[model samples]
Structures are given as structure tokens and as C-alpha cells.
Target: MDSQIRSVLPKTDFNRRSFVVTSIAAGFALAVLPVGAATITTDTTGLVAGEVKIPVKGGEIPAYRALPVNGGNNLPVVLIVHEIFGVHEHIQDLCRRYAKLGYYAIAPDLYARQGDVKKLTSIQDIVTKVVSKTPDEQVLLDLDATVAYLAGKANTDKLAVTGFCWGGRIVWLYAAHNPKVKAAGAWYGRLVGDTDPNHPENPIDIASKLKVPVLGLYGGKDQGIPLASIEQMRRVLKEAGNPSEIVVYSQAEHGFNADYRPSYNPEAAKDAQQKLLAWFKKYGVA
Candidate 1:
């Protein structure tokens, strides 16, 4: 059912790149006023940073692509899945950050087919309209399409995926769904959640079936994801003989990696970013 659902409808709306491209990375997203209050902003100088259209099943979809200035040779690819807030500003910066590390980073606006989340005022409204309606099957296919696009541009031999918040959950789902990824780093994604027709499964539910080694970074004090549940997921993965691992920052809360949000933790965020780099390298994605 999961595989068949998306094969039929390959939705693509890549032409709508309302977000302008900037060579200077400072203050890219104007909507985010007083930027860097909590979220970290990455500069895009000396980088091929701009919006590019990825050819999905139906049509082209707009997405932010970034790579090092001298990344002419075939470079490793890293798919940066955006958070629930959608691919507004911070997620694009993340792609730039990965590009600085010499990895071809691409973050597709997966919610483009449904609607634009940037126009929404409240996070709840974005969640209700965009996040909830997005099917896991579609997300995986979209990521695959992005990978295929990158493959044409550079060396996608070593593929890696990283996501934050809502994207964190997708990290697990994508790792389980695609056998091509070398590694995945999930940032504070929910392990357990209610199931419905629109959303059929959660990360915890599929822990035993994961083929790729996943490194989960969580916050101990996260208000949404409890510590108990993370522990349960760890147990499930270990029992299933899965090589994946989970790491929780004891003093951090949710959005620790989000330097733009109030919940951002500088110490934990730095450490986690290092961990992500190491995990990717250890698994040969770097």
C-alpha cells in the first residue's frame, strides 16, 4: 500500500520559488526578523547557494541547493529535510552549512504540493495544513527524486540524510524505506505518536525494520518527546539487532539545534553538529 500509493501520483510544483536567492548569507529570510536571536544563521558567501527546480514524478519542484565554491568535482550528497515550519529560512541555512563542509546539500520544499507554509502565521496552522497532510510515502519518493537529481549533478555515491523536529521522524522513516542511504541523523524527532489513516506509523513502530544505521540526537528535557519513550526506542532497536543508536543531551530541550528558536542550546547544538559530522564520516557519507 505504501509503495503503490505514491507511484500513482508524483506531485511536483517546483516552479514556485518565491524565496529569492542571495550570495551573501546574512539576513536571507526577511520574514524572520532579528535573526539569530535563538536560531543559528549560516552565511552563503563563496557557495553555489540558490533555488533550483527538482524534477519529481509529475513536474519540477522548487528547492534550495548549496555546495562549496569549488565543488566542481563529484561531491557527496546530503539531503536536508526541513522541519515542520517548512523550508522558509533556517532549513536553507542548514543546507549552506552542509555545503561549507564540502557536501552537496539539497532541501526540497516537500509541502509545495499541498500549500506554502511560509505564508501561514501560526505554527499550528502550518502543522494542520502542511505537515499532517504529507504522507510518508510521498516524502520518501521526493527525497529519492532529489537524490536522483543530485546524482546527475555530482557524485551521490555516498548519500546521507539529516532532519530537525518533524524532519527528524522522516530521517528514520526514510532510512527504513530507502536502502541507499549510508547513514541518518535525526534531531529530536518524535519516537511515538498516534496512528491514523493519513499517518499510518511512527519511528518507534518501525525501529526493528531499519536497515541503515541511524544516529538519533534528542534532548532530555524536550517538552514534547519524553525521555522514557526514547529509552524504549533504544531498547527496541538494540533488541532488533539494529546497529542504529540514539543520543540524548541530558540538559537540553527540544530545538537545541535550532539557533533561531528560543529553545536553542548553543553547547548542545555545537556538540550535536559535530556528532552529525562524525556519524556521517564513520558511515562513509563524508
Candidate 2:
């Protein structure tokens, strides 16, 4: 598919009300294997963890969800979108980490509707075959549906979104799309890009329209995301009323938070996590 992805939600009869529950009963795990770092994997001993099929446009897309041991009403929900590599092991572990933090987190395989990037050998192939073909509008709608699913299960009033690499840009778009969101944390996502009619805009373009508070965590050494682009994005955000903040760690590079990656910076990751917690709490997502 050379062109941007066509709308997939409406075609699937996208239903959020009963989607999460229907997925809750389904089996999941071993969708992908470990590749790098001592990727943190939290036990689901006292928690609800498994695979679920989110009802999308026509067919249901598979995803992994994790929640607290003692489930209650209206728990804060975090939509954990994945990097360009897709919703593999690292992404699933992230959902568990958020679950440990008391938030019901879900990592939907957004790429499932397209193709599994994990099966592809090269990142370049993954980008061209999967990522590029993905439409921005589709991602926003899927995430919105995920929120609605969680809202039905827990309180979504304190909703927050977090994404890594490719997902980081999505966090920005979601914050702009949903005013109900309390906050968002974007990790080293791209700032600018070419526009298409199907893929209408980029994060920098949406800075002025952003409605919710967002914390952008970036790396100065990142090859793909230059400091200048980050600065330009900052300028745009400052010009807007939201004043969303972006932090660039001089020593870090892209995927610094992913322990499995060579560029993972322990200090930077810990500090960023602290700030992310504080940001969420300040914005009421805690």
C-alpha cells in the first residue's frame, strides 16, 4: 500500500462498550519474543493480564491489557501505544509496569489491522510496509475507543496516554484529539514529517490545537529527531496557550527508556519516569 491507510474503524463496526470485556475473557501471551536488554517483566500474579481482541472497523485487532490486583471502579487508564516495531514483548511489559503503578494499561497492536512489523527483519521494511501505510486519523480513533473501553471498566476521567518512538508522536495527537485527557507523555517521537491527504498532519502542526497537558521526553543525540526540530516544536507549543513542555537529555538517544536498546540510559530513564509520574499527578491522571 503506497498510499496512506484507508479508514478502518467504521468498516469494522468499531464498538468499545463491550470490546474490552469480550477481550478480557480471551487468551493471550507469547505473541512475540524477547530481543534486547533485561526488559522488565512484571508478574501478573495478583492482576488481570491477557490478550484481547479490540473490535475495530471490520475485524477485531489483538492486544494485551493489564490491571491492578485489586480491581475497583474507575481506576485511571493509560493507553500504552507501541513503537514502530509494533506491540511486541517490550510494549507488553510496559502495560504491566503501568498496571503495577495502579493504572489499568492497555497496549493494542495497532499494526494488526495493517501488518505485523515484528515479522519483518529490517526496520526499513517495517517502516515502509507498516508504519507509513498507517493513517493518523485511524490511530486517534482506535485510541479513543480504547479509552471508552477502559472508561466502561474504570474511571477514565483521569486518562493519560504514553507512547514510545513511533507512538510518541501519537501521544501528542491523542492529547490534542481528546479534551478529556488529563495528560500525555511522549517518548522520543518524531516532530515533523511530510503530509498526505490520508495522513493529514504531524505533531508540530497540532501543537496549537492541543487541549490537554503533555510532557515530551526527547534525546539530544537522537539521529532521527534533531534538537532543532524539538526546538521548533517548543516554539510552536509556546506560541499556543497550552505551553506543553519538551525535555531533551544531552547524553541520551532514541529509545533511552527501552532497557533492551543500546542507547538506554539508566539515569535518564529513571529521572524521566519520575517526571512522568509527577506530570500525571499534577494533571490529575494519578
Candidate 3:
């Protein structure tokens, strides 16, 4: 574990609220609120699904947690980092899907400290005012808090992480930050970008420091993330002797896994999900 991660972990378990976002946001993020018929909704009939609050420094952040109703503490943990849209229905559904597979999946609202992107109508505004303001340090601490919160409740030792879009970028950083993470699945996240005051590094920058193997799923046609960057990331990983792999779907575009969005690609999304499950099991995250 890194020194910073060591410092943020809860020294002792403390009492905390059950859930925060009691009622999930009505629909998809306002920026891309269009309702597509392909949206996938996972049920919670066999699992405990709903909001859960994670205690942080001075306050608490809300998260969606789903675990098997009968697994108790035997379930593996999968931290589902949400897209820039926040912990909306899609994210919660993902938690349920993981729970159905005997994994305790939790998706914390990483942007809680900055602002809620779900309510904002413009994607650019959400990026500028909310996502941009959220410090990487804060996001990492909140995730650590979430893991600490589930210390005794879930099989934390078999930990895996998966994130989409903006959260995809975080999957890389989290794997680098926490050595205990068994594996990570990053979906169409930017591999390289200009550094700012809050975010000083990209996935390419820390490829050499990654202790956890990352299964990076990308789309060659992704407009926001150029193919050159992905190639660069591959070069960095190889040079660093890292075993990470990046799989690019030549025909898919960014947000291909987002079932509710126009960019959603059912074929690619299904293949990626299967690949993710296999990757986790291969890396001992099961």
C-alpha cells in the first residue's frame, strides 16, 4: 500500500449510516438523458440492494451496495466506480448484477465532495464545475473509506474494481494506489491527458508503478481517447514489465458499454462483460 492510502484508511471501525442516495436519480444524466430501448436493468430479488453511506473525514458519502442475500461474508468485493453521471440507475443495476454473481459490489459517489453531475444538463458544465473540481486525492480516500467500511462484511481480500468513462480513468489510479487490489477493469477511460493542479498524473504516467494487473477495454473509435494514447500506454506497460493488457474493439466507440446511450454497442458490451468476469477469476478476484 502507498503511504497516502495507509494514512486515509480508517484506524478503527466506526458506526455509519446504511445508505445515502435513498432514491436514485430519476433517469440517466441530464447531459445524455435520452432514453434508449437497449437499457439493461438488473433485478435485486435475490440480493440486498440499495444505498449505503460511507463515513469519511468530516462527513459521509453515499454509495450503492449489492450483495447476495445468503452469502454473508463469503462474497468477493467489486468496487463499481460510476461514470461522470454519478451513481445513477445504471450503476446501481451493475451492483445488482455483480451481487447476483456472488460479489459484493459497491459504487460510491466519488463526486459527492464537489457536486452532483446527474442534475446538471450540460456535459461540459458537469466536467468543468464538478468533475474538474474533484481532487484525485479525495476520490482515492473515499474509495479507501468504502473498502474499510466493508472490512468485516465482505471478502475484502478478493477485491476487484471496474469503472466506466470518467471512472474508468480512476480504475488505473486506484490499482496503482492500492497494492491489495487483485485486478481492475477499465472501460474506455482516457489513458493520457494534460495534467492539472488536482490531477497530476494519467494512466500512462503511472503504468510503471501499477502493482495490480489491469484489463483495459477500449474502443479504437473513441473520439475523446485517441488510439495513439492507448498505444503509448501499451508501450509504457511493456517497458515497465507490467502484465496489463488492453483490448480494443475496432468498431466500437466510447461509452460502448452504456446501454442507455446512443454509443452503446451490445455486441462489444456483452463480450467485455464476459471478459471482465473471466479476468477477475483469473486474477483471484473471485
Candidate 4:
């Protein structure tokens, strides 16, 4: 951890007995072992970056926050929802990236109440034990709590949200849930899926109801998310007269922006990031 990171971290004894996943893990999750050679690491130089506690419903949840060292109050806020692997190194690095770009970025451990997925070695096991059991309502509430935590620290009115994988799906729901959000960038999130009590709606279900403009970045070759579903979402948005747009990278796969994964696509990731920033700026979130 950088000295700046240590300085900003809450001065509290974060032990396992006190909270689930008391602190952010050092590296990638066990499930994504053998870190890719292209893994990107963002240093906390000239930035206040580290772990902080977000007061939620039942209790507090651990969250990683990063922002400019000299940035005063009312900075633009960007909420980064994590992948199924949790808020590991990649997500932390992403926060730093946003901080470098003059945004107050935060990524809360939405799975803190359930279980730590970092220790789990298999993807399926993590999904069954942690992800599957997590309720969408709880996740949204936690996000609201996170924003509440920001109160005077950042400008909530200029709020923007972006997520990946599991978190990507959440970006859509959150936009519909919170009208204060100015813009959102969803990367490779599922558009359609079976409805259940925990997850009663997908992005497709709420396409027509979305008031906030959203930019959906999808991978054409993503096996998990079919192109047809993306088309359906686009149709719904268009029919509803929504300003949202979906862009597909024909050569990219899922997680193309995750530099620490095998699915990472440098070209696509770079372009998508540029588009996300432009989207945020276009919608007055910058």
C-alpha cells in the first residue's frame, strides 16, 4: 500500500471477527490465479486511495475509495461496482484510474454480508455461495448507502456509475432506481435473464423506464450475453424514445476491459474507456 493510501484508510482495528472481509485483499482473487502478464497496476501517487467503511443497513461494509490528493469537496462522484470476484486488485486499480482523472471513485464490497469470493477457488462455487444469494434490493440499498456516505465529500448531483460483469448488470438497475444519476456505462452486463425474487428484473425489463442516459458496451463474441439480447435492449430503448445507446466491439469478448484476465482486449478496452468518459461528459456527469 502507498503511504497516501495508508494515510486515508480509516484508523480502526479491522479484524475478521468484526466484519466480513474487513479489508480489501492484496491481489487478484484465487479463482483468477496466475495473473495475466498484461495486468494493469495503478499506483496511489498524488492520490488518496485505500479502504473505508460504508455504513449500510445491517452494518458497515468495506469499500475502496480513491480521489485526487488535493481535490476539495464536491468533486464529481463515480460509483464503480465490482465483478463477481469482488473488489479485488483490478477494481482497486480502476478506482485509482478514475481518481487520476479527477473523479471521486468508490467500489464497495456488495458481497460483504454474504461471503468473500476472493478465497473461493472456483467460479461456480463463488456464484452459488455468494453471488446467487445476494439480493438485488440489498445491492441497490447498499449503493444508496454508499452515495449517502459521500454526502458532503463529493457532488452527488453529478453522479456517474459504471460496472463490469455482475456489477455491469447492476449499473442498469441502479440507473432506473436512482434518478439522480446523470449517466451510466454498463460493460458486458446481461440484458435478459429469468426473473426471480432476488432478481426480479433485467436490463431489458427496465429499458423503457430508464430516465438516465446509459451507454452499454458489449462484446459481440461474449458467449454468456447473446447478440440477440443486445438487439432487443436496443429496440426497447429506441421504441421508448430513450437516449441510451449500445456499442458492440465485434472482436472483443466479455471482460475485455479487465487487463488482468485472459479475455482482455487492449484495443477494445481503450476505445470503450474513451467512449465511457465521453458518455459521462455528454450527459453532464463530468
Who wins the TM-score comparison?
4
Q: Total clashes, candidate 1?
A: 8
lDDT of 2 by residue, 1-286 (tens): 1112223322222233322222222211222234455556667877888787666665566778889878686689888988877777677778888988999889887766556676676666766666666667778887776766665788888788899988998898888898998889999987786666545777888899999888999888888787888999999888886758998899998889987666789889999999998999998887
Q: Can you give the TM-score per candidate against the true fold?
A: 0.88, 0.87, 0.91, 0.93
Off by over 4 Å in 3: 1-26
Give the Å error, residue 75, model 1: 0.7
Ranked by lDDT from best down, the candidates are 4, 3, 1, 2
> Model 1: runs farther than 4 Å from truth?
1-39
TM-score, ranked from best to worst: 4, 3, 1, 2
In candidate 3, position 139 carries an lDDT of: 82
- Candidate 1, residue 150: lDDT: 80
Give a tens-digit lDDT track for model 3, residues 12-50.
212233322333454567877776899998877988988
The residue-level lDDT of candidate 3 at 10 comes to 21
State each model's CA lDDT, in order: 0.79, 0.76, 0.83, 0.87
Residue pairs of candidate 2 with colliding backbone atoms: 9-57, 11-57, 12-57, 12-58, 13-57, 36-260, 37-260, 74-154, 74-155
Question: What local lDDT does model 3 show for residue 252?
Answer: 98
Could you give candidate 1's per-residue lDDT for residues 1-286 as a string of tens digits?
0111112223333334332322223233333344565665678888999888877766767888899988885888889888776677788888888999999998987876766766666666666655666667767888988988886687877899999888898899999899989999999888887765545788998899999999999999888888889999999999999989899999998888878766788999999889889999999987
